[model samples]
Target: MSLDMSLEIEGEIPDWEALDNAIRSVGVINYEIDRDYVFQGAFKKSDGYFWLSKRSEAQRKTVIAEGNHGCSFCVYNAIVFRINNFYYDDFVEDMNSFLKKLTSLSSMQFVLSFQYEDVYAVRNKRGFEFFWDQPR
Candidate 1:
């Protein structure tokens, strides 16, 4: 089974010439970043199931982009990305913290997962963070 994680943020994404810039900025060494920003050797490198944005071109345009920017992925959001099924917490946390530091505007998050369930980390107008579950 493959596990997926996505970082969803709005506003002020840090400029990175390559995905390596972001990966290195987070201080995770030993993982190779490719030109596509796809997972190369982090986890499950031998398995084809562990692929991010596995959707076809037409499918990705419809499903992932949601008509926003015409199937192009924004750095602020990573949808359906592949990672180790059991060992993705560090990745998620690091991504969250990395994004939070890019701007002073604060942020919120909505994550839907089949294994971990749906989680929303919301940053309110008061500049505080809160968590809630969806589909209640």
Candidate 2:
């Protein structure tokens, strides 16, 4: 199955270099980063998952509000991680593990979304825009 993973980070990481290092440490194939989000390209692994790590208070608030109230900020962040196919249970487990590791090292609160493929910004009737793709 094809798996697309998106990781969100708020604030600056003192060890920003570790971001790529951590992902590499996971041994996944086709990993790519664009701005603040990291996308692990489609993988054939049994299971897959993505982590949204919030390093700042603003980022944490965004996650909580989006999760609890469908906040626009959350909707925008959701656009980056889109997959074209369904995943198996193993994918979910692996994703959770990845998230756990990121949070443990970064001290950032994270939210986990499993087997989600629909891109929110494009699909939403409201035409929400993703943070990364916004015109400068």
Candidate 3:
């Protein structure tokens, strides 16, 4: 299952490399094309992108997305914030601001992501915006 924030920026992401580098301290930006080569007889995956934070505890954070060369829907290409944990907050926060900073240049929209944790029959809502400082 793929998931992330509901907000995102589309079109040419300015200074994409620099932006990727800036967030390295939190997580890594992985373009699908860079890895996962197709077998000689297999078909190559289309252009898509996404990233994940190294696992620290029992869980890991990720954003399965697409860029200009990809279709709009795949994973939660529209990253919102947080999964079911708070430790992943910083990365979410940083990306939030990063996208916010680019709002003027790219076409992006932040939408509400409904999340819930199930404890048997009860569902606990743990919704909040998570973030980190963007490297200067």
State which candidate has the highest TM-score: 2
Which pairs of residues clash in candidate 1, taking residues 3 or more apart in a chain or in different chains?
none
- Enumerate residue pairs that collide in model 3: 4-80, 5-78, 5-79, 5-80, 6-79, 6-80, 93-130, 93-131, 94-132
Please say which candidate is ahead in TM-score: 1 or 3.
1
Error of 2 at 38 (Å): 6.7
RMSD of candidate 2 to the truth, in angstroms, is 11.3
Candidate 2, residues 1-136, lDDT tens digits: the string is 5555444333344234554455555556656666666544433364243333334445443433222213233322331243434555555444444444554465433233323322211112232233222211
Candidate 3 stretches greater than 4 Å from native: 1-4, 8-27, 33-86, 110-112, 115-136
In candidate 3, position 32 carries an lDDT of 28
User: Where is model 2 more than 4 Å wrong at Cα?
Assistant: 1-8, 12-16, 34-40, 47-61, 68-80, 83-86, 114-136
lDDT of 2: 0.39
- Per-residue error at 17 for model 1, in Å? 2.3
Candidate with maximal lDDT: 2
